[model samples]
Target chain A: MTASVTSLVNQPYKYGFVTDIESDTIPAGLSEDVIRLISAKKNEPDFMLEFRLKAYRQWLKMDEPTWAEVGYAKIDYQKIVYYSAPKQQKKLNSLDEVDPTLLETFEKLGIPLSEQKRLSNVAVDAIFDSVSVATTFREQLFEVGVIFCSISEAMREYPELIQKYLGSVVPVGDNFFAALNAAVFTDGSFVYIPKGVACPMELSTYFRINNGDSGQFERTLIVAEEGSSVSYLEGCTAPMFDTNQLHAAVVELVALDHADIKYSTVQNWYAGDANGKGGIYNFVTKRGLCQGVNSKISWTQVETGSAITWKYPSCVLVGDNSVGEFYSVALTNNMQQADTGTKMVHVGKNTRSTIISKGISAGKSENSYRGLVKIGPKADGARNYSQCDSMLIGDTAGANTFPYIQVQNNTARVEHEASTSKIGEDQLFFFRQRGISAEDAISMMISGFCKDVFSQLPMEFAVEADRLLALKLEGSVG
Target chain B: MISENSPIILSVNNLTANVNGTQILKGMNLEIKAGEIHAIMGPNGSGKSTFSKVLAGHPAYDVTGGEVQFLGQNLLELEPEDRARSGVFLAFQYPLEIPGVSNLDFLRVAYNSRQKHQGLEELDAFDFDELVQQKLDIVKMDAAFLNRSVNEGFSGGEKKRNEILQMALLEPKLGILDETDSGLDIDALKIVADGVNQLSNPDNATLMITHYQRLLNYVVPDYVHVMANGRIIRSGTKDLALELEARGYDWVLDEAAAGVA
Candidate 1:
């Protein structure tokens, strides 16, 4: 059974097929001229250009940090194309005007871009390469005073909102990847929920990287105003390539007084081959801020792909009586490595935060959970609870947990719990003695291990996350 | 009790097994027939638990030489799960604690796997819930235990009862209880023995591996076999257990060695 598990994890990447289409790609390299050309290609306003230039200069001065517990070959920034997009009709009036090939690509990826064809109550913005090809349910969202569009389109139509909230939570020079994303991000979803109006549907964005050797740097910003609420979803996939591809994305979310924002992500980027030959290097920075009284921000993510993943989706509780939550499940198989978790910073009195992370390692992969919980001096009545659990499938796999707690307030309450477990021979024998197949036994055990985190996701996303985890861990135990 | 017409349920011959390259079972042999309860009593390090695990096809035990026949088929050829689906159940001496998997779900899966093996329609959740609730009574277990993780945080007696509950649910043709009475108090032992007694029928057989003769007092065995050094060295009627209990295992081992000489 262990041999079969090793073979199963070595199965070829399913989403490795490249779509043949004409792509207008910029020259390989990063410079002031490259950033300017990308900004000009998007036809952005002067302030947007200024923001990009500033971010570029900061990125040039920064160095990639090697603090994460992951190893990889050094990335040559000069050999990467900063921007690449499929050549299609410049302005698509409707799904009918979308190129047939592009629509077929989305269809093949199991994403329905057509409003009438979508079955779930989800509005999808399909971003291929560096541009948003189509967005569904725009009229329904626009009717309710909700602004959901591509960030570039938002810059053109709603510049004031973009200028007001963009980078307000996660600054442009926050980190190495965030700075890079800020400098050269092509396009991503922008969402603005108006005051006192709950978004009628779940908003989602599906990102796909098709052009080989092109780095995908997309920026997503969500702003929930007073008394407004919205739940957003993000999913990504990339085609196969012999050369490693770079993906650095930055996502910022803000919630105002009495508002709430729930963000969930199912990341299934192309993990390299079983031998760790080629795959996406996912370096993402996602953060949310509860900026007003009684506001809430929650993040739920299931990360199962990418050859090397270094991300930490965090929450900043700046509002009194606010709440912050982070639930995550990170699974790595074969040669994959993941160093992902969350940070909760409490700056408001009586603020509360909860963090639950589950990491499963199979084959020879390494999975780690690094988290931090900080209570400011003035936050006298703050509280935080955290639990991090790791499960190793085989003897070759590894799991690690690193939790940092800093409390400056004497009255604050903070608790952290961690455990490490292995899917040993006894557990499998017990299951097999009851007639469960090896694969089913592993899947059942993993699902049970991750039940806490999976429960935090929305209904549809929870189901998908369960299925995705099962698929990834198929034949991973004896 | 060993009637000439009784059918054989399990037959083991010259079974030699090793664990981590260390010989644990040296030419062990035993035979069990339908409707008969057999007790195998031995001292520590006698490979009693290893015998049960080998029968259950545990992967850690390497079978150097063995021939096991269950219901006239080569049991050694089947996978562990297939052995289970074919009505061979080994109530573990140490039941695993699998957290997050609810007892109800685990029982349902085990039950449905057997049902599917028999080419029977799998039971849905509602129907399985009803069936499992009825089976839970055999062990006198609370319905509330069904909601918790499988044997997680359960007391020693509760875990033993849970093993019986699974046996009651699966209704295996051959049930082997390995040291099920090891940690149970007298009252718990009586309850577990009663559960086993209620499940035993003319079509099924039970094999009890125990260190004490006290358990045999509650659920009397038809035959008693004394094992030593990984092999059964003596076999007799139920009276043999009482005699051995009074005299201790040393005299039996000495007698077996004298007989061999």
Candidate 2:
């Protein structure tokens, strides 16, 4: 079993093929001038440039956080290109106007960018390297008053909405990674569901980083207004590189009175080789604010890649009788390390939150779930329930759970449960005795272990996540 | 009921095995023909369970020196899953609890594996549901058990019954019940015994590794063997079980020791 798991963990990254296209890349470095250059290249307004400048100044003073349970060498910011975009002849007016090589790259990544070839119900905003390549279903979304486009495009077209809500949920200098992302972020999806309007279709964004030396810093903002609801999906992948790439993304979400926002992510960045030579350093900050009475926000994520992952998608329940939920499945294999969970803060009366996290570690990997649940003094009758489960495939892998709960109100209730289990020989033997192969048995067990979290994902995303897990853990057992 | 020309289903000779460097099966020998029900009764640590596991090709047990044949194929050379696909089933004494994997899906996978092995048409989900529902009747299990995770929260008797349900689904040529009667109540034992009896036929065989003679009253074995120190010390008809029950295994051990001396 160990041999098979070793072999499986050594499986090459499937999405590691780099697209050979002419790119307009800035020199590798971080300075005030670099930030200004990025903003100027985007033709941004003065306010946007000021936002980047302030964030860049704040980032320079903040120190890199080492509290996460992941180990990696210090990253040299001076060696990473902050901006890299594919060279294009002109601004795309239609899918045909887009570079065919770029479109083919998306096709190879299993994301059909063309309208006729795309999934009908899903509106996709494809972001490659440092720019939004194409966005489908714009007309349909516009008719419903649902503004879904790239953040860079939103800055130029809907600056009022961007200015009002941008950094409102996650302000500049919120954290080290968020600060850096705010300064250098080139493009990400922007979603706005109008008041009393429930979006008719699921909105999705696919992010890809093709340049090896460039860092991807995309900022996503989603807002669901009063009595409105929307479900947004995000997916990411990066090419394999011998040098670790930096990805510091920031996502903010806001839900108003009686509104609901469900954000799901399927991140499949290229993890380093078996020996941990190179991979993506994914440090992300995501937060949602339940801003009005009876509002709700939920975050569901399936993280299966990245050499080092440090993320916690959190929710702040500030509205009366609001609700927050976080469901996540983080799998680490072959020298990968992940420290991920969620935080729920209850500041309103009768607010409630639920957290379910499943972590699977195989092939000398380390996985940890770190979560916090805090109930404020005014959060009377607040409630929280959390369950963190970990599964280790081999003897050398590791799993840890650190759950912090604080309740300042006497009427608040908090409950947490944690369990650690190993995929022992007995379990595999039982499956084999029933004529099931070792790989199939392991996959079945893993799927079972993560079913609770997977159930919270969108239908198509759930299916895709399941297949990705199977592919990731292929031949992972004897 | 064995016919005159009954074919041999399983044959073991000098089956020596070990687990964690400790020799468990010194030189066990056993044989079973189609249409026969054989029971091996032994004391604890007598390697009765180890013998059954070795036959199923469990990875933990190292076959130091042995030869096993099942349906004219070299069983020892096959992987555990291949051994299972080749019509050999070992009903575990403690069935594993696989949380979140529906029993229905588990059964379908096992059933289809055997079907694919035998070159039979695999059943789809709809057809499999129909087929598994019919087989569930053999053990008198509730249909609700099919949707729950495989034995995740089942009672002792329910887990044993679920094992039988799996057996009924796979329809193996040689079924080895490893202490399946243990932890079962009188009623559960009767239900389980009845299920086994119903599944038994002229073209297949049953091998029951047990410690009690009480189970034999319901599913009568044609032959009973007394095992000690990893090898069968005496072989006889069903009366041997009653005698051993009345006189205890010490008598058989002393008699065998005296004979060997």
Candidate 3:
């Protein structure tokens, strides 16, 4: 019975196909000269070059932190390709000029970059390897003063915005991976909602890492001015390779007074084979700053891929009466390891934050939820509620929860609840006795366990995330 | 309710089973007709619950030696789910609490599985909702319970009612109530018993494993058997249950020993 269920869910990664595009890949080395070349290659402004140099110097001074529960071989930074993009015309006026092969690849991944076939309500910036290939619906967004484009393009077009909010939330010297990303990050989506104007449609970025030898360092930044609101989503996938790939990304969000920003991610990178031979090392730094009164930011992520995932999408609530929320569902199967959660820092009076995290572990994988909730000294009347739940599929799998709470103010209230459950034999028998097959039973229970987090996702993304989890859980029950 | 012409639904001969290498059911024998309700009254460790679980093909119990036939099919050869699909249902003594699975969805999926097994068209959500509402009336359950997770945070009585609700939805040929009356109060017992009575028909049989005569007072079994030392030593009508209730099983055990001597 377990074998049958395994056959149903143990499907090979469907988005693991490599695109046959050529040229414009930098040498496999990192140095001051390489950083200069990267900045020179993109025709970046002088300030951008100085920023990269500063971040590189800081990264050189810092050591890779070893506090995470996951273990991996020492990474050799000098051996990675700092830049790789599909060689194309200097500029693209329309989707027709884009490479057909690249367009077909995104289409196969269920993300159509072509304007005619793109999803109606979503404007996607499709990023390949080290650069944005195409960003759909730019004209429709331009009408509303919503600046939606690639970060590199934003640097050339809206240099003022880039210089102001580039590393405002997640500074370049914040962490080891963030520093590395700030130094060599090439392309990611940029969204700026002007004051009082809600984004017309959902903004999204679909990242595909096609090159095996190069590391993907994409930087994304979203800023919502006062009284404005925006919902952004990100999706990622990579081709199968015997060699592990490095993906270090930095995402920052800035919300002013009365602004609301909802950011969601469905990360499905290649998680290597069942033996845990090769996959992507996803180390990301994502943070949002609620900088003005009554501003709000929420992070929702469904992570079901990567060999090792270590990141915390956090919120630094700096405005009075600001609110923050984090909803996440992380699933690891077949030798995968994920130590992911969120952090909420309250520095404003009357601030409130919520954290709901669900972790599912199967096979010989290890899944952990590490979170922190901190209330500053002057943040009177702050409140926080956090719930962390873990579900294990088989006896070989493991789950852990680490919740840290610091309250410097007496008026602050914090509540935390956590639980761990396994898909026990008796539970399966109960379903089987009701004539439901093991495959259906496992999927139903999983979706039910993840309902709270999945409900926070966009309608279509929720469905897709559910299916992705089911597929990843296949063959894990034996 | 038993008629001489009624066909036998289940036949057990010299049935012996083991759980964790310890023999639980030793040389048990029983036979039930299609229209009859048989209640097995026994003390603790008398193998009453084990018999129900073994018949349902529970993984924990091993049928070491047994000749069990359900409608002339070898029941031991089937899997737990197959046995359920083939019209055997066991309303658990402690109904497992499955958090996050809505009761309505659970009932619909179970009902649809049986429907598909019979080669019938499965009911969609709309039709199933209407059907489930009608079945809810049999157990006097509120429609509100349907939206909640299966038996999650349900009171003892509510969990038992949910079991009967499932039994109503499945409509099995042989419904085994394994101590379903243990945790309920008088009111819940009456409602559950009424549900069992409503679902019982001339074409199906009920085998109840209970320790109390309270449940029998409402459902009124056609035959009551005294189970001791892993086998039934005496069988009689409803009067036997009242007699056992009045004077525990000590007399019956002495009588059975005397007969053996």
Candidate 4:
């Protein structure tokens, strides 16, 4: 229910145009029957099938996490459909050989799988609902000794790689969502850049939720060999629904000696209607690994959507001389609740990390920044600096910051700072006196609040993020 | 005809206001007319800024008593924005900064608010820019200043000059400059005073509130009033400013205390 441009305040659902899609969706329920059906339908190997069953058994024995700041009853696994796929799509030989309807669907989602300039060097894995749409550039990547394709395809073609790294960082029993994802992950990207060979262009995986009522469960894994570097971008969205949609995905990244990886996420899920109904629940587990000396990883995200968001893209520095950095801006409006941040664990000597999070809340929404930095006993010379700022626009909105630090090593240095302030009425009056309306003034004020993080985005994305924030935050203030 | 005895185009009778249950101004009253320049000099905590705050109808300040009649209408009844819309301007002592809101955008809103109040057609962005550029000349501010956030990161002098520029754009009937010259150097003081002088006309009145008489040497008030402890203790002509400057406020303090005795 997108509002007309003339009146941005009153419109309803953000991504409401349901595709005239025909999907093969199984009945709701998560049990041995559903797990076997998913594996049988995908024609998985014996070990893959066993992995799913083991994960399902582990999930049943585990209880739901009770520690998150979010408030919601335990989700009923019996009420969720584990798999759904585009009805007409079939396996194809080339990009052009893929279904035109499938390609058109992604194009409408603002993703281009075959753009001449960008597609030449990059690989594309388009996950439409619970199935991979068309993963192009895989043949070229394979020639260069790289592994780039859907996780399902990777499980079929390069099972050894998947067996080695899958569920290593976030195990099958890491958390409730992670366990569920491990049991029945429908589709996600799998990337492995070979030794000493940097991926020539950014590798991206686009996840589109087209089948209604079915929660999207995807799993992503990335590994970089020694002396190699790769930058990955993950983008996700969903069709609108009257009832809330659920998305619980798990992502893990592993880097070897002297390897580096930068993961950037631009999440634009449908944030439900302004009244806070029918948007997607974006819950994800993303983490990186520094397995060898001098490895580095950075996470940058601009979160502007989601009715309820619970995600923390984090990093674990297990290598000496490793580094991690996180920069994020989360905006919530009109019943949108976002409890997102990062966690950095320093287990190596001479490790450093920095986190800068900015949260803006408006229209009775709640935006919180929850982050942690823990240094281990041998993490001597470890350093961390975290600054979280919260800006509340209207009286009814809320903003909070919770930063947890555990420094066991006296040689480790850590610092955290937080401040919360409401947009002053005098500031609004001052702008109004100059000719800016209440809405435009609010936009200006928020832009200023987010300027620091906005400047950190890539050039094209920085401009896009700025304009998108302005559009989403329209009428965000009185 | 503009009444000379009614030298003030505006008059306030026993205005009282409070903020969050704490009274700041008690029965404040003053009068000003066209062609007259009045100086309202007062010691600290004497309801100087409170008078300006009340006139502008700051929501934080609640007027609990009396009334203010501006251009022959009840002023206290108007909202702060409406007060500004109806030719009443307050040059705040401490101008607030709104980061990321450009000076130009803020000025356009002020211009349109006044226009909309009178049911007049508002100007487009280009036309509004042209209108503001003309008034910026009165303050002698730089063209580049329009791109910066309102009062954000501006020097003390720039903030005051921006306030004066706003006054010129609104062209109010009764202008209240609250401690306008507090932080200005000699050169900045001359420039600010010169700007106020250029915008003054016989059809409008200016009430300058300050702690010192130094601003008078530039704008040259026709009448001066000494206020202390919430009331005006003495009134005199321009020479009174010089007398007060030579012999500080304690002389008026002795006379006021004796009168009370």
Interface Cα RMSD of candidate 1: 0.7
Worst 10 residues of 2 chain B by lDDT: B96-105
lDDT of 4: 0.81
- For model 3, residues A119-150, the per-residue Cα lDDT tens digits are 99999999999999999999999999999999
**Model 4: per-residue Cα lDDT at residue A365:** 81
**Chain A TM-score relative to the true structure, per candidate:** 0.98, 0.98, 0.98, 0.93
DockQ of each: 0.84, 0.73, 0.65, 0.29
**Per-residue lDDT of model 1, residues A1-478, tens digit only:** 3564564444455677899999999889999899899999999998998998998899889999999999999999999999999998788788878888988899888897766677468899999999999888888899999989999899999999889888888888999999999999999999999999999999999999998889999999999999999999999999988778999999999999999999999999999887888889999999999999999999999999899999999999999999999999999988999999999999999999999999998878999999999999988799999999999886898899989999999999999998887676678889889998777787788889999989988888888888888777674442
Lowest lDDT 10-mer window, candidate 2 chain A? Answer: A1-10
lDDT of 1: 0.91
- Which is the leading candidate under TM-score? 1
lDDT, residue A254, candidate 1 = 95
The order of the candidates by lDDT, greatest first, is: 2, 3, 1, 4
DockQ of candidate 4 against the true complex:
0.29
Any runs in candidate 3 off by more than 4 Å, and if so which?
Answer: A1-9, A474-478, B13-29, B41-47, B59-68, B74-79, B119-130, B211-214, B223-261
Error of 3 at B257 (Å): 9.2
lDDT of 2 by residue, B1-261 (tens): 867699999999898999999999989888899999999998999999999999988888899997898999899999899999999999999998887689998898988988898899999999999998899889999999999999988999999999999999999999999999999999999999999999999999999999999999999999999999989999999999999899899999999999999
Off by over 4 Å in 1: A4-12, A475-478, B258-261
